[model samples]
Target: MTGTRDRLAAQLEQWANRAHAARIAAPRRRPMPAGFLRGVSYAMTNRVDSSYASPRSFETLRALAKRDVNSISIMPFAFSRTASDPEIGFIHRNPSGETDEGTVLAVVHARQVGMSAMLKPQIWLGGGAFVGEIAMDREEDWKEWFADYRRFIVHNAVVAEAGQAELFCVGTELSKTEIRDGQWRSVIAAVRLATGAPLLYASNWAAGAVRVPFWDALDAIGVDFYDPLSANPLASDAELVLGARRAYAPLARLASTHRKPVVFTEAGYPPVRGAWLTPHEEPMDRPLDPEHAGRAIAAVFAALEREPGWKGVYWWKVFSDGQPAAPGSRDHNILGRAAERVVASAYARIARAVAGAPAR
Candidate 1:
C-alpha cells in the first residue's frame, strides 16, 4: 500500500509540473460572459478543410436559430490508440473539422448566426471504447498520459480563446482519471491560463458528475446525461416524467451543494423503439420510432425545466453540413423527426423566458 501511494504521488507531481508550464505558454484574453445554452451538439461527420464554416454550414446554424435553439456545443475530437494508451493528440491526417482552424471557423460562424458556441474537445479511443473507461495501469503511463492531456487541453484552450467561444469544456467522461483530484485541478488551471472562456467538465451520467472533487473550480456542473428514464418501453409519459425526476433528484442535490448551475452537456434518445429503456445505446433489431424519442425529451423537460439549478440541455447531435438527417436513421438526430418538434417546443420556452435573448 505504501509503495502504491508513493508511485501515485510521484506520478501526480511530474504531471502537475508539465501542466503548469503549459498554462504559462497560453496567450491572455478576457472571457466573454456565459449564456442560456439552449442548443444541440454540432458536427456528426469528420468534415474536410473549410467545410464546417462554408455558406451551407452557416445556413445550418440559421436553421437551428429558427427552431429556437440559441447555442451549439461544437464537438471537436482527438484520438488515442486505446483507452489505456495515454498519448492523446491529433492525428496527422485528422479531419479538418477536428483541427484548430476548423474549430475556430465553426465558432465564428455560430456567432454570426446569433448563437453561442461551447468549444468541447472530446477524446475518441480506438475500438469505439467508452471514454469513461479510460485508465492507465502503470504509474509511468498515467504520468505520461496526464502530461500529454494537459498539452491537448491547453492547445485547444488557445483555439477556444481565439474564437471567443462562450464556454470551454476541459475534459469529458474520463472518470477513471477523476481519482487524481489534485492533478485534475492542475489541468484546469492550465486551461484557465490558456483561455478566459468559462470552463466546464463533462461528467458521465452515472457517477463522475456526483463525485468529481473539483466541481467548485468550474463555472457550471456538466453531465452527459443519458440516464434511462424508464425501463418499460410502454411506460406512459407521466411515469417517465416521474422517473426523470427521481433520477435527477440526487443531481439536484449535488447542484444545491455546489451552488452552481447544472447543464446537460449532452442528452438525446435515438429515434428507436424502447430507446427510453436504454437511452445510451441503439439496440439491434429495434424499429425506428421518432414518437418515442419525442416523448422521452418532453418528459425530461417536464421534469427539469423549472428546477432552480437547471440551466439547459445540449441535444446529443445534429449533422454539420446543414443537410437533414436521413428520415429512417437510427442515430440520435432530432432534425425533422418528432423529437425535433419537442425540442422546438422546449427551446421556444427557453428563448422566450430563460435566455430572454431576442432572435436574429
Candidate 2:
C-alpha cells in the first residue's frame, strides 16, 4: 500500500512538472474577444457512466459543430439536499464519483471538435425547487458546508488544470451562499492554486449576480440569465426581443461598473405553449410549439447582438445520450428540435461577427 501510494504521488508530481514546463515554453496566445464564447451547454446525468466515451456523445458534438459554436460548457452536477447537509455529494457517476474524470474527457472531446471548453460544476438539490433556497442559520453548519464544497471544487479544479480547459466555473447558481463573498473569495483562491484557467461564479441571474460583491475576484461576470421575458403566450419576436433588452439593461450597467465582460452561463426556454409567459418554468404537460421555441431563441440572440456589453452565451442544454427528442415533447432540451437550427444560425452569425471585430 505504501509503495503504491508513493508511485501514484510520484506520477502526479511528474505530470504537474510537465504541465508547468509546457506552459512556460508555450507562447501566449492572443485573447479571444468579448463575443468569443459561442457556446452550448451539454447535459450530463447521474446514470450515464463514461458519457464522453459513448458513441452518442460524439454525435452530440457533431450536432453542436453544425451550430457553428466555438465553445461548449460541460456541466456536471453534484448534489446536496440542503445547505445544512454535512457534505456535498455526487448523485451522478456510477460507483459515486467521476465528475473530475468526466469533465476532463468532455474537455478533450470539445477540443477535438475545435471548440473551447468550460468546466461548469453545478449543485443539484435533490427535491429542492432551487439552489437559491440553500442556507444555514448556524456558523457550524456553514463551516461544514464549505469544508465539503471546497474539497469537491478543488478536486475538479485540479482536473480542469490538467485538461487545460479554457474556463472553470467555481460554483453555479448558489444565490443564498453567494452573499458570503469573503468565504467565496477563499474558495476561489483555493481553486486557483490548482488551475490557471480563468474562473467565474455562475449566479442564478443578473439580479443575483449583481448582488455578488466578489465579481472582482473572478475573470468575468457570469449569470444564468432567464429573466421573465414576456407574459404573453403568443408574444411576437419583436416583443420578446424587447423584453430581453429590458433584462439586459441593468446587467449592462453592472458590467460597466465592474469593467468586466458578462457571460450568460446558461440561458434557455422550454418549447411550450406558455413558455414566453414563464421562461424558466418546466411544465411537462405544456403543449409543444417548435415555432414559438425557435422565436424565443432568436429573440435572445437579437438582443445579445444589440447589446455590446454582453460577451457570450451557452444555451442551456443538449443531452449527453444524444437521444432524439420525442415529437412534440415540451421539454427544455434543444436537441433535435427546430430550435436547433435557430441556435446554429445564431451561433454562426455571432462567430463570424466576432471574428471580424476588433478585440475589446
Candidate 3:
C-alpha cells in the first residue's frame, strides 16, 4: 500500500510540474461569476476519528442558518477501523445495533436539504469512500469495487434526489487507482440517471492532476486543499494565500480549459500550537486570535474573489469542539476560533453582490 501511495504521489508531482510550467509560459485567468463567492464547511457529521456519536448533526445546520449562512456539504461516506468493516455500519449501529444506518443518514440529509432549500442555500453531498479504494494492480478487484461503488452511488443519489440536492460529488480523494480505472465515467452516468443533479469529484491537493480524468464530464472541479506548508512559526496570511494560489494554479487552468467552475470542496487552516500535528504538518503553530483569524479568513475570501473562474471556497469545518487553536489536537475539527463569523461576513458579501446585480 505504501509503495502504491508513493508511486501515485510521484505521478501527481509530474503532472503538477508540467501544469505549472505551462502556466508560467502563458498564464491564463477566467472571470468569476457574481454571487459565486460562498462558504461551505462540514456541518452534519462528526470527525471521522471521533468515537462519540453525534446527536442530531442537523442541529449544526440550524445554527449555521441562524447566522444567515446557507451553503453546506454533507459527508455520507461509510467509515470503519479497517477495510473489512461495513461502510454503512457507523450510521446504523448504536451501542447494540439498534437502528439502521440508511434510515439515519437519510433523515439527516433530508433535513439538511429541506432546511437549505428554504434558505435558498446550495446543498452538496460528498459520496465519501463509498466507491472504495482504487487498487493499482488488481484489475479484477477494481471491477468488483466499481460494481459495489455503483450501488452506493445509486443509494446516495436516491437520497439526494428525494432531498432535491443542488450538487452531489461522485467521489473523493481516491487518487492511487483513478487513472487506471475507467469506471468513474460509469459512476457519473449512474449518478446522473439517479439524481440528475450537478456532479463533482473531490481530489486532494497531492492527487490533483493524476486522478479523475473525466474533468470535462462533470459540472465543476472539486479539490481538497491541504498541501504541505513549512513548519515555520509565523507564516503570514498573504504568504499562505499566495502559496495556495500557486499550488492551485494547475487546477485553475484545467477548469478554464473545460469551462467548468472550480470549488474548493474542503480547505482549512488548523489553529494548533505545534510544529507537526497529526500526519500533516501545520504551516504555523501560533494560536490564532479570534479577531485575527477572522481577518485572515476574510483576506482569503478577498483573494479568491479576485481570482478568475473560481466559483467559491468551502472551509474544512464549522463546529468542532468550538475551541480556539484546537484544530490539530486530539480533535481534527477544521473550524477553530471565531472563524464562522468571518465566514458569515464573506457569504453576506457574496449575497450582496448577487442581489445588486441585474438579473440574467
Candidate 4:
C-alpha cells in the first residue's frame, strides 16, 4: 500500500513540475483596477451527499460581506422540493436537522438569520436531463419535455418572486441542449415571464463558445472557470498568475465583443493535489493543503483584478455537513479550507479599496 501511494505521489509531482515549467513562458501580468472588486459565496445544494448549507454558511457570508460582498447566489434546484408537490415547502435539512418546505420559506429562514443583501439564486437545467440520447433521437418529442421543464423553472420563478432575488440563472452547463432549435430563447422567455429579476445562464468552460447563440437572449455572461491547472507542483504565485491570464484571455475578449459583464458562476482550487479534473469527472479526494489552496486562489484574484469587465466571482463552495459520499473521502467539502481563507482575504482587500468611495 505504501509503495502504491508513493508512486501516485511521484506521478503527481511530475505533472505539477511540467505545469510549472510551461507557466514560466507565459505572458506578462496586468494590474486590475483597485476599486472594481466584488465578492460572493456560492451556496451548495444536495447533489453531492456531503454538501449541505448551515446557519454558519450564512454567518460566513455575512462576515465575508463585511469585506464588501454586495451579493449572494443560492441554488434553488435540488435543495428545494419538486415542483409537482406544492405542499413540500422546503425539502432541505437545515443545520438544526429540520426540513422546510417551499423555496420562499428557506430564504426567509436565511434572512431571519441575517443573510441580507441582493440574493442571486440559480436554477440548473440543460444537462443530461434536458438533452440525453433518448431525447435527442425523438426531436419531435421536445415540446412536451420543454413544457415540463418550463413548469419546473416556473417553480423557481415563484421562489424568486417570494425572495426578491436580485439575479437568477435560467440554466447551468447545458451546452448540447442550448444549441437546439431556439430552445434557449423559449426558456428565457418563460423564466422572464415567471420572474422579473435579471437573468443569466451558466455554461461550463468547454461549452462557453458554442453557447454564444443563447447569450443574446440573456442579460449577462455566466461561466464556470474550473479548467484543470496543468503546471509544476512548485510553481510560484507569479507563474500561476501568468498562466491564468493566458487561459482566460479568450474570455476577456469575448466579454468585450459581447458587451456583457462576466460572472464567474463557480471557481475554486481544492486544497489537495490531483483534486482538479475536467467537468465530466467527479471531484477526487486529497488532503487539504491550506497553503497551496490559498496561493492558487490568490493567483486567480490577481488575474481577475488585472482583467476588465469581470462583474463578480463566486467560490465553488462555502460550507457542508453530512456523511461522506464514500468512506474516507475528503471530496465532501465544507468549512473554510486554505483556499477559502485566501479568497476571503482577497475580498477584504477589494472591499478596502472601494471603502468610502462612490458606487459605480
Candidate 5:
C-alpha cells in the first residue's frame, strides 16, 4: 500500500516540476463530447472463464441502471510479479479472467440496456506492491517495462475499439509512471493509431492527478478519487461533507487549467470502520460499519453534484456476480451495504437534475 508521505511526495513533485515545461509531442488537443457519465465499475472474475459474458453480468448491469447509473467502466486486468519485474503482461492465455471477446460481450450487453461503457484496462501487481511502486532502478529496466506496457495498452485500445466503448481508459492509478512524458506520448499515439475512441489515463486522486503530464494528450481527466474526507474516523456528517468540498476545491482549478472535464473514474469508501480516514485502502482488521460507509459516500455526492467542471463519477467497484471479493479483506462492494441506498438516491437526483436543466 502507498503511505501518506509517498503519495504526497509524488503530488508535490508534479507541482514543483510544472514550473519546468514538459516537451511532449502529440496532435493538437481536442475537446471531449458533451455528456456526463454516472458510472459503476464492473470487474471480471479471474477464475470464471467468460465471466463478463455470463447472464449474471447482464443482470448486474440492469441492477445498476435501476439505481440511475448511465454508464459502466469495464475492467480487465493485466499482471506483474513485483513492481520492478519489468515483465508486465498476461499470466496465461486469458490474463485476469476476461478476454477481449468477453469485454466485447460486456459492452454489447451494456448497450442493450441503454448504458454507455468505458473499457478500462488496469494492472494488478503481485508481491503486495502498489502500482505507484512500479519504478525501475535501471534505464534498461524502465525501457523493458514500457515496451511491454505499450503493447498491453495498445491491445486494450484495440479491444475498446471492438467493444465500441463510450470511453477508453488507457491505464489507471499508475502514479510513478506519469512522469514518463515521452514514453507515454508514444503509448498514447499507438492507441490513437489503433482506435478513434476517446481516451483517458485514470490518475490516482490529488497528487497522482497532478503527476500525470499527458492529460493534455487525452480526452478528459480521469481520476480515481480516494482522497480522505476526514482524518477522524468518526467525523460528523457536516464535517464529512466539508472534507469532501475542501478535497474537490482544487479540482475546479485543475479543470480550468486543462480546459477539460474532470471525471472521477473511481470513487468509493470501504464499508468498514474508519474508512473515511484512508478511503483508498482496504484494511484487514476494520469491522464492517455500513453507516460510516454510507455517510462517507453521501458526503462525496453532496459536495460534487453541484460543483462546476465536474463531468461524472464511477463508483469504485461492483463485481459481476454482485458481491464483495471477500467479507473482511476485500469488502469494498456497495451492494447489500447501506451505501447502496445512498448511491441510488444520489444518482437518481443527478438524473433528475440533468434531465430538467440546461446542458452543463
Candidate 6:
C-alpha cells in the first residue's frame, strides 16, 4: 500500500509540475457561469476505491448532473494519532481506499459529466476518536506533526492541481492545530508551491468555524455546516426553514466581516428519527426517517438561498456506486430517496433563477 501510494504521489507531483509550467505560458481560460454549486460529497473508502475508475462511478456522476448538481467534492482520507502523532500515521492512499490515482480519475470524470470538482483532503484520528478533540501538548510535537502534515497536503495539492480540480481544501476541521496561526500560515504557503487552485479550509461549524484565525490566508471560508435547526425531528418545514435562517445568519455576518464567500463544504442530516435534534452528531442506531432528512435538506437550501454571503453547499455524502438505501438503514446516503428529489428540485430552482449564482 505504501509503495503504491508513493508511486501515485510521484506521478501526481510530475503532473502538477507540467500543469503549472503550462499555466505560466497559456492564456487564461474563460470564466465559468455564475451558477451556485449544487454538490454532493462522495466518500471513497478502501472497499470502493477502485469504483472511481469504473463505469459505475461515471454513471453516478452523470446521474448527479441530471439532478442539476454543478459540483462534486471528492473527499480523500489520510490519518493521524491524537494531534501529537509525529508521523502522519498510516497515509491511507491504500489501493483498496482513496488512492491518488483514483481521486484524479474521479475529478476527471466529474468534469466530463459537466460538474466541477473540489478535492477535499481530510485527516482522521488513528483511534477513531472525534477529530475535533485532536491536539498536541508540546512544542516539539507540533513541529513534527506539521512536517508530516505538510507532506500529506502537498501530495493532495499536486493531485488537485494536476487533476485541474476547481477547489482544494488545505485541511479540514483541525480546530486545535488551526489555532497555531503561524504554523498554519506556513502550511498554506507550502501548498501554494504546488497548486494555483482556489484553496480553503473546512472548519467545523460553530465549534471551530467561527474561531479560525487563518480565514484571510484562504480563498474562501469553508464550513461543515451541521448546526441543528430544530429540536423536533418532525418539525414543520416552515419551522425548520426559519430555524435554519437564524442559525446561518451569524455565519453570514462572519463572512461579511472577512469579505470572503462562505462555502458549506459538508452538510447533511441522517435518515434517522430525531436527527434534527443533534444534526452534526453521527447518527445512532434508529428507525429510518427519510421524510425528516428530506425536510432538513430542503430547509437548508431554502435558508441559504436567501443568504448572499454563502457561496455553495455540498451535501454530506453519497457513494458513487449507487448503493440503494435499504428500508431501515439510517446512514447518510440519500440516493434513491425523497431527499434526492428535494436536492434536484432545489438545484433546478436556483439554476433557473440566477443562471450561475452561488447559493444566492
Identify the candidate with maximal lDDT: 1
Over 1-360, each residue of candidate 2 has an lDDT whose tens digit, in order, gives 999999999999999999878743221222433446888888764445427655567667876776797788887667887655657886434522345666787788888888888888877777865877788888888888888889888778777777888888898878889778788988998887878788878888777777888988888888898887888877888899998888888789878888888889888888887566666677777787767777888888888775666778888777776665777667678777867878888877777766757654
Q: All candidates' lDDT scores?
A: 0.82, 0.77, 0.53, 0.55, 0.81, 0.79
* Ranking of all candidate structures by their lDDT, best first: 1, 5, 6, 2, 4, 3
**Higher-TM-score candidate of 2 and 4:** 2
Task: Judge candidate 1 against the unseen true structure and give its global Cα lDDT, from 0 to 1.
Answer: 0.82
Given candidate 3, what's the lDDT at residue 232? 40
Report how far residue 64 has shifted in candidate 2, in Å.
Answer: 1.5
lDDT (10s digit) by residue, model 6, range 13-117 = 999999888844321222322557788988764465336766778888888898898899987777776655666754445666777788899999999889889
> What C-alpha lDDT, on a 0 to 100 scale, does residue 231 get in candidate 6?
80
- Model 3 misplaced regions, further than 4 Å: 1-34, 43-59, 80-137, 206-211, 228-232, 273-296, 319-336, 358-360
Two-way TM-score contest, 4 vs 5, winner: 5
Please tell me which model should have the higher lDDT, number 5 or number 6: 5
Candidate 5 lDDT: 0.81
Model 3 lDDT per residue over 33-136, tens place: 23453545554333432211243444445555555555556555444333332222223344322123423343344355433210011212244232234343
Alpha-carbon TM-score of each model against the true structure: 0.88, 0.86, 0.67, 0.69, 0.87, 0.87
Error of 4 at 44 (Å): 5.6
Candidates 3 and 5 compared: the better one by TM-score is: 5
Q: What tens digits encode model 4's per-residue C-alpha lDDT throughout 34-81?
A: 334254444544443333235434454455555455455566543222
